[model samples]
Target: MSKPTPLSGFPEWLPAQRMIEQNVVERIRATFELYGYAPLETRAVEPLDQLLRKGETSKEVYVLRRLQEDPGARTDDSLGLHFDLTVPFARFVLENSGKLQFPFRRYQIQKVWRGERPQEGRYREFLQADIDVVDRDNLPFHYDTEMPLVIGDAFASLPIPKATILVNNRKVCEGFYRGLGLEDPDQVLRTVDKLDKIGPEKVAALLVETAGATDAQAAACLKLAAISTGDASFVDQVRALGVTNDLLDEGLEELVRVVDAGTEYAPGLIRAELKIARGLDYYTGTVYETQLQGYERFGSICSGGRYENLATSGNERFPGVGISIGVSRMLGLLFGHNALTISRSVPTGVVVALPAEELRPACDRIAQALRRRGISTEVAPAAAKFGKQIRFAERRGIPFVWFPGADGEPDTIKDIRSGDQVEADAATWAPPAEDLIPVVSKA
Candidate 1:
């Protein structure tokens, strides 16, 4: 037999670490449900064509096939593990459009696979917590504003560091580039999106070589990307840039609406960051990227955008706005830094001590009573000396140990950590609220 080695990009957490992850997920799920979003789950694989229809994600799709299938079978309709929830959701909406109502809102928490090089906060397989609102035909612009507020509330409920959501509208970038007389706005956006990675000098060169932009036009594009504001004042800043176009004006108005809404509701949570050109071709309106306050270099721990035409049924269009929390990425960074604490490694609150194998039935009854009252309890694995039994509870961090009464005496319990043993009844005894379950908190 060989020792097991870890796969590079797949993350596996210890029990204490997993408790923190579960706590974070529950908080996010509760926040999503509080905002009227219903839960949803989609199949893990989608047709490769549908997964590749939206962006430059073709390289990231993990294609699937049956090992015993014919080798010469047609591969055009091959299936691949979904890289993100949005694409499968779009396909789901289109497939079930007739049964679904208008303005469908859903929150999905599932593992998505991507074939990419692993890093500190990036993984080949990861969990994504996503929320999206899709409407028939014309989707309201206000949904764009609503997306970040929900995300803000979710992050607020977590134990992680504060998350700042950086927002921008595609129309703003495309219109600004067109206003500067650049013919290939999309190419320019794709180039500028790498500004953080390649820097301004390299991005400027790529703009000229790839997007066919003149030096002055590339400078204007860079200038637009540099505009970031905490409020609607960004509207005036863009105006000051001296570029004029109707689409740019429309985008500015939409972005200001989002920023203003964020200000009134979740102040200091959202910002108009012009450089957040999401590297997806499907995004037609506002885009978002979230940065954990001190872990900015790890890149966006949450991201998504508004796509007006990702799902279509002939003349009908299902436009939507969404955001996804990179659950694995955030946990990876936090766990790597030892930023979370768990009160206990296991959820057990009380361990019914076994005095003898003959009294196992009595101990089982005591365990059932504690569980009936909502206290997580387990019976001792073996009948051992009282001292050995207490050591067993302490080893697993179980707070209380119960001893069954013998010879008509009342049963008793012990708080092993404090050595506080007292006569008690299994039917009436209960631990304090905090000790009933494992508590997860910031270290």
Candidate 2:
């Protein structure tokens, strides 16, 4: 037999690490439900054309093929693994429009695959927690604000650090570029989206060479991207830029509403950043990007935007706003830094010991009694010495070890951490609330 080599991009966690991941996911799921978002899941694969609808992401898509299929005999749409949840979700909405409720809100947590190079917080395969709200025709502007508030609540509920949602309006950037007499605003946006990747100077060069922007226009765009505020003051800052257009005015008003809502509800959680050009072409309105307070250099951990027509049937349009949290990316970062921990490596709260092979049934009954009371219990594997049995429990971080009664006397449970042993009845005894499940902590 040969030792197996590990794959670089695919991530797998140990038991304790996975415990933290599961806890984080459950917290996110509960938060999504709290906001009235129903759980939904889409198929793992979609038509290649459907997955490639968004041009920028097409190169990242992984095409699918069956190993045993006869290539020449097949005649069907080419299929590919979904890169993100949004595209399939849009297709789902359009297909089930008649059966679904209007203003549909759904939360999806699933694994997504991408063909990009993996880094510290990036993986070829990962999990995403997404929430989207779509309306039949025109989606309300309030949803743009609600999206961030929901994100704020979810992040606040987790053990992670405080997160800031950096928001921008596509209209703001388009109007500002128009005010500067730049003919192709989207090109400038695509270029500015690379500002963090390539330096500002390269982005400025790209704006001029590719987007046909004059030096003054490129400089103005750079300046606009530099303005970011925590509250409504960003409205005044954009006004100070002296770029006035009808679309710009509308965008500023909407942004003011979003900032105000954040201020009123989740203060200091939202930031108005003009330069955040969410690279997707479908985002026609508000766009969002989130960063952990101390990990801004790592880039956005969650991001999304409002699409005017994510799904359509003839003239009917399904407008939607959404945000997706990169669960795997976040956990990768946290786990790499040893920033998160679980109190136990296993779920068992108590390990019932057997004094002899004859006492096995007694231990089994006691284990059943504890389990009936909603406590996780496991029986010792063998009738080993008391010291060896305690070691087994200690090795797995099991807090309590139950020693059955001798000669039909009362049983005793030992708290390994404190070495406190006391008489207890299996039906009535229980571990403390905090010890009932693995506790997650942040370093």
Candidate 3:
């Protein structure tokens, strides 16, 4: 048989890299919990109809089927792996509405799949860290501004470079489109969403040919998309556009509130970029797109928005605002570029070396004693020369090597890097606090 080959989009990281990934996840989880958000998880598969509710993402949905099926089995209702966490969360809220509390806040970090072709930062299977606030009815508008702040906290705790969150509201886009005398505002929003992929020239042409916008209207849309400010100054810029509509007025006010809060709380981190039309159909309010500093070409590493009517059941509407960090994608890009690092490969802090195979029991006892003291300890695989034992610890990035006491002598531990040998009792010995756990940092 031929040697096995690795898949392109399915990422597998080395031991040190996985350590960095775990640290990132823990930091994000801790931040989410600090804000009073509970943890949640949803199954991987959902009915095909539910997955296809958003028409644009249908092409990326991956369906699952058994290799062998009964000849007469019915296949009317099919299943597909969920392309995103938001869809599954919406279903969970509707299914468990009665059991959950009002204004439910949840943080979910899980793997999601998409069948789209992967390139650069995009992946077919990836991990996402998502936090959302859902309400039974009449969701508070203040939650819209709070979404980015939560994301800001999570990202700030990680070792990666800073991220700038670009904010936009669907009401802003729709109102401006209607004010321009455009009949289909949704189509215009979708077209404008492609501004990053295709240049503004192509977007403007498509707006005219597909969305039925006049040259002046398309220009106006382009101009609106170009308005981005670090604070509430964007409101004055939009007002300067000379557009007047009730929805536009309302959207402007809401955008101002969100921008002002972000400025006051997470100053210089949030920006009001009017052209950020989130492509998702369900997003009826504020939308977000995040760009990592010095990595803008890879596109948004995190994004989400407010959905006013995403989850509904028999007259009860659940509206929510959320943000999702594309964890796998971010890590993959950083790892590929050698931007992340971990000081150690394995969790073991010290390796106990046996002078002879007969001292296996003693080595085991020493390891156990250290472990009870909250220290990570491992025993050398076999009895070998002192130099060989030291090499074993060095190869795995284990900082220290412990020699088992012979003939009733006290235990001695050697700091492998410095070759400093010190006598100590197994019960009271401890590694430095910084060396207890692997250190992850930005390279």
> Highest lDDT, which number?
1
User: Could you give candidate 1's per-residue lDDT for residues 63-135 as a string of tens digits?
Assistant: 8999898999999999999999999999999999999988999999999999999999899999999999999
Ranking by TM-score: 3, 2, 1
- For all candidates in order, the CA lDDT equals 0.92, 0.91, 0.90
**Over all chains combined, what TM-score does candidate 1 have?**
0.97
Q: List the residue pairs that clash in candidate 2.
A: none
lDDT per residue, candidate 3, 1-443, as tens digits?
99999887777778888889999999999999999999999999999989888648988888888878776787667899998999999999999998999899999999999987888778889999999999988789999889889889989998889999999888999999999899999999999999999989999999999999989999999999999899888888888899988999888888888889999997888999998987779899899999999898998999999998889878989999998999998998898888988888999999999888888987899999999988999999988899999999998899999987777888899999998999988999898999999999888
**Tens digit per residue, CA lDDT, model 2, 29-134:** 9999999999999999999878877748887888888787787965458899888899999999999999999899999999999988989999988999999999
- Superposed by TM-score, candidate 3 places the C-alpha of residue 312 at a distance from the truth, in angstroms, of 1.0
Cα-based RMSD of candidate 1? 1.3
Model 1 / residue 131 / CA error / Å: 0.6
Model 3 TM: 0.98
Evaluated at residue 171, the lDDT of candidate 3 is 92
Off by over 4 Å in 1: none
Runs in model 3 with CA error above 4 Å? none
- For model 3, the local distance difference test gives 0.90
